[model samples]
Target: MKLLALQGFLLIIAVEMVAVLVHQQHIMLWAAGVAVAVPLAGLRRLLTTGDAGSADGVPIIDEPGAALRQWLSGTEARIRWSESTRADWDRRWRPTLAGRFEVSSGQGRVKDPAAFAATGVMLFGDALWPWVDPGNVAPAGEDGPGPGRAVLEEILRRLEQR
Candidate 1:
């Protein structure tokens, strides 16, 4: 919105400048045409490139953990935090040091633990980190959606924050 306003201001200034500097009628007309054309291009770009979050419906998980698990299955992992967590990553989550994100795999490490765990939280939420431990921030209650869908929404919110 700010960008569009700035472009409008600039277009007004340019049109004024062109009208003042270009005395001949033909040159002035050409300049005006170019000025309008430039701003139209900018407007087109602004309208086309919009926020991806403004979609119509909420992002629902049809198959619960299975979809995310399958996505992770194809992911490449450089390190495995635990064989157990890796084994149950789909149904029940056990946090580990390393995790493979949606597309790229094996990129996370001990230093950047979020690289792997962030996606896991999005996929499994409370299952990934039980209430018994600390640093658990999963959503509460069953008001809006089921556990799987709620976790999926949480994941989307987390991704948008990034």
Candidate 2:
């Protein structure tokens, strides 16, 4: 993530430098436009691209990416535990699961460990919710499976049905 941010920054700087070298005010404006547009485009893609299924219905888990598939599987397994309380849930679970996933699947380590772990925990929470509270219902935005929780929920549902 840091590398991506740095690369984006550098790309912006490069565009600005080129605009300056050309002495084009319009080009500078164009550079500024790109500077604003690229990240927003990325953000949009991030926000829109993830799973978008409702918790009331079955979630789709058709991700073709092997690493992502494994991550989803690991997330589902971690959440099925009922004996462990949230306070007692181990923080190391994410990294440990991710590591094992990396090894078994031959996928590389997550780029951002903290972010990955945090996401894993969120996924775990979502998956465990149905088991923890059968009557509990997810809210509108909260119910849809998206890149963050959605993908995990979908995978968990699939696993549970299996």
- Provide the lowest-lDDT 10-residue window in model 2: 81-90
How does candidate 1 fare on TM-score? 0.27
Measured with C-alpha atoms, the lDDT of residue 32 in candidate 2 is 79
lDDT of 2 at 128: 42
How much is 12 displaced in model 1, in angstroms?
3.6
- Per-residue accuracy of model 1 over 1-162 as CA lDDT, tens digit each: 566568777886778687777666566677767777787777777578643322443434357889788778654231121222323333233122122233333434354556545654554455633321123423443223223434434443543454
Q: Could you give candidate 2's per-residue lDDT for residues 1-162 as a string of tens digits?
A: 344477778878888988888889777987878886897676566467763445553556665798888998986666543123332222323333344433443323355555443444454455543332212334434433223344335544543443
Clashes of each: 4, 5
Residue pairs that clash (backbone atoms under 3 angstroms), model 2: 50-147, 51-145, 51-146, 145-150, 146-150
CA lDDT of 106 in candidate 1?
44
Q: How good is model 2 by TM-score?
A: 0.30
